[model samples]
Target: MKTAKLDKLREQIAAIKAEIVSVERAQLTTPEIEARVDGFIQEMKRTVANDVLDSAGTLTYINQLGSGAGNWPVVGSWMHARPAIGFAMAVTLNPEAFRAMVLEAALKELNGGRQEHATGRVELVEQLRGKLRLLEQDEEAEVLRLEENGIDALRRADADPAVVLGLAA
Candidate 1:
C-alpha cells in the first residue's frame, strides 16, 4: 500500500514538473507583440507632443491656474478632469520619460498574469515535494516492517501464499 502511494506521489511530481515547463514556455508577450506595442507608444508620443505644441497657449493658461503647476494632486486632478490635454502636455514635456513610464506600466500589466500562474506552479511543486517526502518515509517504514517480519508476514498480509512460501525458502 505504501509502495502504491509512493508511485502515485512520484507521478504527481512528474506531472507538476511538466506543468512548470509548460507554463515557463507560455509567455505573455512575443517579440512581435513587444515591437508592436513599442511602435504604438512611440506614435502616440509623437501625436500627443504635436497636439500639445499646437495648444501651448491653452497649457500655459492651465499652468497659471492653481490646478496645473507644481502640485501633484492638483495636476492629477486636472489630468482626471481633462485626460487628453493632460496626456498631451505630459508627453510633450518629456517624451522619453513618458514613454518609459508607459512601457513600465504596460509591462507590469502584461506580466502580472504570468507571474500569478508561475507562483501557483511554484506552490504546487512545494506541496507535491512535501507529499513525496512523506510517502518516501512511509515506503521506507514499510520496507523495514517487511524485512523484520520475513515471508511469513507477507503470506499473512494477503500476498500470494505460494509466492511467499517459495520465496521463504
Candidate 2:
C-alpha cells in the first residue's frame, strides 16, 4: 500500500512537472511557443481522453503549486531532467462545482504572464493553453469542479476513487 501511495505521489509529481514546463515554454514569448500552445492543448486532450488527466484541471494544480507570480517549486526540480514525467492535471474538474476545469486550467495557465513563466523551471505548460481554451461549452464542468473541490477533493480522490466516483455517478 505504501509503495502504491509512493507511486501515485510520483505520478502527481510528474503532472506538476508538465505544468511547469508548459509555463516555461509559454514564457518564451516567441511566436513559435505561442503557436505550440495548441500542440500542448492537443496533448492535454489525449491525456484527458485516456483518463491520464483532465487537461485544464491539471493546469489549475500547476497554478496552485506556483507562487502567485507562477513560480512552482514542485515543478521546478524535475522539469529540467524529465519534462514528460512532471505533468499534472488542473486544480478543478467538475463543472457543476466551480470554474469549468478546462477554462479554469486555461485561466491558470495564462495567469502567470510571461515573466513568471519565463523561468527555465517550468515545463510544457506553454504548448497547450490555447487549445485547452477551445474546449466546448458543455465540456467545461471539470475545471469548475476543481475550483469547488480544491485540495480536499483531490485528497479524497486519491484516498477513495470509488467513493468519489459513487458520489459523482
Candidate 3:
C-alpha cells in the first residue's frame, strides 16, 4: 500500500514537472503564467488528498460522514464538520505522508532553484494576497510621491549631468 501510494505520488510529481516545462514553451503574459502555475498547485493538493489518503476503515468512516457513497465534494461537504476533526486527521492519520507529498511538490516547483517562475507554496497560498495588496498600496503611494518629487528630483539630477549620461550609458 505504501509503495503504491508513493509510486502514484511520484507519477503526479512527474506530471507537474512536465506541466512546468510546457509552460516555458509558451509566450504567455506574466499573469497568465501565474494562473497556470496556480492551477498546478491546486492539482498537487488534490492529488495528495485523493490518492495518498484512505485506508479501508477510514474510508468507511469518511463515507459514513454522510457522503452516502465515497468521493470528494460529498465527503468534503459532510466534513463541513468540525475543523478540529480535519486537523486531527491531518496530524494523526496522514501527517508524514502529506509532508512528503508537499516537499516533493515544492522541490518540483523549484526544480532545484533553476525555475525562476516558481513561488513557494505558502506564498502561492497565503502571502500572495498580502504581497498583492502591498504592491497595490505601493503603486498608489508611488504615484503620489512621483507627483510630489518627480520634477524637482529630475531637474536636480539632470543638472548634475552625470545622472543623465549614466542613464544613456
Candidate 4:
C-alpha cells in the first residue's frame, strides 16, 4: 500500500510538471507579440490603400492628387511601437474584453481631431470619419471594461527599454 501511494504521488507530480510546460509554451514572448502587432499594422495599411484607391477611382487619378495638406493619419503609423505592443498584449490576454477597449481608444483619437474643410485631404478625413462612425455603431457596451488591465499593460510596455527606445523588432 505504501509503495502504491508513493508511485501515484510521483505520477501526479509528473503530470503537473507537464501542465506547467504547456502553459509556458502557450504564452507569447514580447518580441513575438510585437511581431503580431506589426502584422496587424500591415493589414491596416492594405485596407487604407484599398480605401484610397476606391476614393480616387484609378491609380492615375491618385497620382495626380499629390500630397494633401491636411493632417491625415498614416495608416501604418497610427499606433506607435510601444503602445501598439501593449495594446496587442492586452487584446491577446483578454480578446473579447480588450478589443472593444482598443477600438474605443482609437475612435477617441480619430474623433478628437479638429474638423477640416476645403482641404486637399478632405476625402481621406471623411473616409476615416465614416469608418469611425461604423465602429462606434458596432460596439456593444461601454468602453474600457478592463481599464485597469489595459493601463497596467501600457505602463509595463512604456517601461520596457526596447519599447521606449523603439527597438521593438
Q: Evaluated with TM-score, which candidate comes out highest? A: 1
Tens digit per residue, CA lDDT, model 3, 1-169:
1234334433443454455455444343444455665565555556446644543345555444533343444446435754444554554455556555655555555443333334443344344344433433333343345556542211221122332233321
Count of steric clashes across candidates, in order: 0, 48, 0, 0
Cα RMSD of all models vs. native, in order, equals: 13.1, 28.5, 21.5, 26.4
Per-candidate TM-scores read 0.29, 0.18, 0.22, 0.28
State the TM-score for model 4: 0.28
lDDT of 1 at 23: 59
What lDDT score is found at residue 135 in candidate 3?
36
Tens-digit lDDT track of model 2 for 1-169: 1234434544554465566554555544444354455556556456545543333355556445555535544344445654554342332232223234444454555565654424433333533432332221112233335456562222323233333233331
Kindly list the per-residue Cα lDDT of model 4 for residues 27-57, writing each as its tens digit. Answer: 3433444455556655555554454434444
- Give candidate 3's error at residue 8 in angstroms: 52
On lDDT, who's better, 2 or 3? 3
Best by lDDT: 1
lDDT of 4: 0.39
Candidate 3 ranges with C-alpha deviation above 4 Å: 1-78, 82-84, 114-162, 165-169
- Model 2 regions lying over 4 Å from their true place: 27-169
For candidate 3, the lDDT comes to 0.44
